[model samples]
Target: MSIKKPLDPGQEAVSLCQHHPREELCYSCSDCDGSLACPECVTSTHQGHTLVKLKNTPDFVWKKLIEHYIQKAEKFEIPKILKELKFAEGKLEQNRKHYQELIGVVQQRGEELKEAIDRITMRHVNTITEVAKENTVYIEYYQGELHSLHTEIIYALRKCHQANDTEDFSVVLDSEKIIRAGLKLPRVPITQTTKYRMGPSPLPLLESAFGGVEIVGYRPKQLGPTVPHVVQKKLEKPEPPKPALYSVVSEFRHLTDITSLVPTEDVYSWISNEEKKEVVLLDRAGDVKQTTGLSLHIRDICTSPITNNLWCCSEYDYSVREMTTPTNTEVRLNFPFVPRALALTHNEDVVVGTFRKVCVYNMEGEEQFMASADKLGRQIVASPQHISVCPTSGNVAVVDWDEQSHDGNGSPCVTVLTSDLQLLFQYRGPQTRALRSGKSRASSTRKNKKEPPPSFWPTDACYDAAGQLFIAERTSKSVQMVSNDGTFMRNLYTDQEFSPKTVGVQTGGFLWIGFDFGIVKVIKYKQ
Candidate 1:
């Protein structure tokens, strides 16, 4: 006669539904409480119900179930169970051997007592000693076998999980096949040798013997931490709200050409790059308060909102200088490349934009971090012409000019980065029709093909008190306002009177726009 093997769930070929066994179940009905459905069923019975496709679920329940069992065996259950079993088996073997030795000693003592005591008492002692050892050999044999089987089971369990985890189907199949065949515990039949009988004690001097049998209970030791330590506390002083800046305050027009501007609490400092004599500091009324003269040829300047210390970079010396006062000037750090632009971070670090990359340096001139390339290993800044840091978010904004872009016109784009130099996004501005310059289309095509004009050639950028970025393009006279996330908000200015070059935000939220012809506008651009 032929025999059949039972079906295994692991090897079972799953079907669509119990009723429509041929069709595959691809989706589950959401409204009908997870009822299995095929495409045909979706149109029929489950037409109105929202359907969730099986393919959409990244992790299947079967995979999770297998993982759970494996974790239980490896991390918690198997090791603990095996340890306990081994401990119990050791105690059982030790007790059994100890009892046999004790029986031999007691039997020798009983033989001596048999000579001294009456014949009846001697006979009873012999019967009792024999009864105590009748099941010792059989019980010990069973225990040893049980321990061996437990060890095998533990090994098998570990191997099965390891095979399952490694996705070794053949190993797992072989293991489960052996397991299902059943490795039962060895059956031990106890043979009755002697009956339970009262006996004269071998150790007659001691009334109660056999280690004074006692049931000792165990209480598990507590593993929780006894000492409570507080790690975090709520901030006592919350940050104050940022003031709104709306509309232009006043247009501060100057006679000298202004290259860069930095706003302090009481005054605004404008650097005339054309002149090497001094940096002019003016009050709100456009009155010159002081003119700080230094040895460096200032390319850009920035003042801290917290501290009114003036920081300026020189193109000729390739160094950044910090000026606490007009007379007190110190060369902070010297760089190989010229520092084109500068921004002061909240922690008083100076973010210097060099030829190739943007670098953040502390007050002691120690380099903290840099943004030379993006997360995907793509170079972010080609020529970091201008840079700005958001006071609130600490996000670094840079206007990089691509020197090799578009037949030498230089394609410029703004890059927004986190304080840690992670590239959040790069804004290239709106995709508009390119405005061609230089040669005629036909003539350029005949000689060298003409390319589109650079869309955003931003010369400088500054962040307002509310963390809004203002980009000043070289091509346009207007200053474009952008959100901290690089979203273009609106044009802050579009006037023929001034051609905006570099921009700065004053302490009281005034937008300071410096023009090529020494025209500086101190306008409020936010509400």
Candidate 2:
């Protein structure tokens, strides 16, 4: 409870404790709330207290303060603010460009609609005019016949009057001729009146055609607090447990040439065969729920997350069909190129993989975006055979193959892209050493001497609940699992006899895999 007086600028840099005015202050007492103490004060008033020597305190305190300042300046205060500013500026520029493009699209669509309206109006006008002209021609011919009959009647009447006065017999004969002409009066042309039948207003349709804009709020990147060098050296986090196949849950047979398999929220899956042009819905117990026969051969099939409607792709007709029931189906979209794969995103957007591009469409069948090439204008995919969308991240994964390779199998890779169509990464199988290490020695040595190890030919892909990608490799006869960040994690399953053609991951940790020989095996997995 002592009050120390402030020292003057000219005063010496040494202080005496208030209680011990004769003794110099040489210690700071922690128990007394960091109060300065003299040797006599520590022993008498603040005994058994933690004390820091005043002579040694300057180095430790000043050094800590300097380090804190340096860290704030280097890590958070200066660099973070600068980076955030740059990011905001870049975002603004991107927004400007995006809106500008939208405006251009609206203007172009307006012009096209106007031109179409004009053409339709002119066509209707011409049709009405032509019909009116034909009707007028018939009316004119009838009027001419009536005029001729009137003239004959007038002549016959004048001749009859002369015959009455001068006794002429020829006048009666002329009257008879006039009567015959009048009896053959031309049949009155029954002209049907033409009028315009107006249709419903196009306001609602126009509003849908010119889709509304979606404004997404900007979210700044979050940065963690800067840690000191000493505190940063902590134990590493343990790796996540690798996924393992627990058991074969079920086996489905009787379906021929199963090209695609899509699992629904329930214990059911939809499978299709291109050769038979049939789509069958079956439960986990291998019981067929429904069967649908389509005219167009199905290339792939996917179920909507929201409505659970089946979306089927037809390569032969270059179209996609949406089926609500076994008998109710409608053409969802028609593409210029063949649609090889189909997938529905978390938002229920339809994703179709074609010859060299993947296109994303809203449920209304309007194109939202497309990805075919990289930012550098280089071709990203020669042929997108299969497509999958991550449920959590909305990221798109395409199994692309080089269709023009010397061997028909072609080199295949999985191209991962962000929801916005930005390129994330491409995974071209794992290293050869990693593959060999996974196989047993006997299996590795049993390979044909002439035939080398088959190359990676990914045919289909799907994302698990944990965002891990499961890709089915046709030539390798294995299903590869990739981490969310595009790292090759490991092989989930391998079969030496049958090649994997398609893969589907259900909600309850079940993986449904389809082979080329029309067999589907459902396996339960654990992480």
Best by lDDT: 2
Error of 1 at 16 (Å): 78
Clashes of each: 8, 0
- Model 1, 1-527: lDDT tens digits are 11223378566344555445567777867576455687778788888888878778557744654576688779888899999999999999999998899788877766765555677667888777776677777788889999988887787788888877987756656467558877887898576765442222245344333234344697544323442333112322457896543566666667678777767665565555635646888765677877877775787788765567887888888888878777777888888878888888877888998765889988777889987755555566767767788877788888777554322124567777789776777666644322222211111232243556665667788876566778887666778887666667677777675567887776665777778777777777653
List where candidate 2 sits over 4 angstroms from the true fold.
1-244, 405-409, 432-454
lDDT on C-alpha atoms for all candidate structures: 0.70, 0.77
Please give, for residues 96-208, the per-residue lDDT of candidate 2 as tens digits.
99889989997998898889889999999999999999999989988998899778777878887888898977767848766555556668887868856344335657788
Model 1 steric clash pairs: 245-526, 245-527, 246-526, 246-527, 247-524, 248-524, 249-523, 249-524
Candidate 2 clash pair list: none
Candidate 2 has a TM-score of 0.49
TM-score of each: 0.48, 0.49
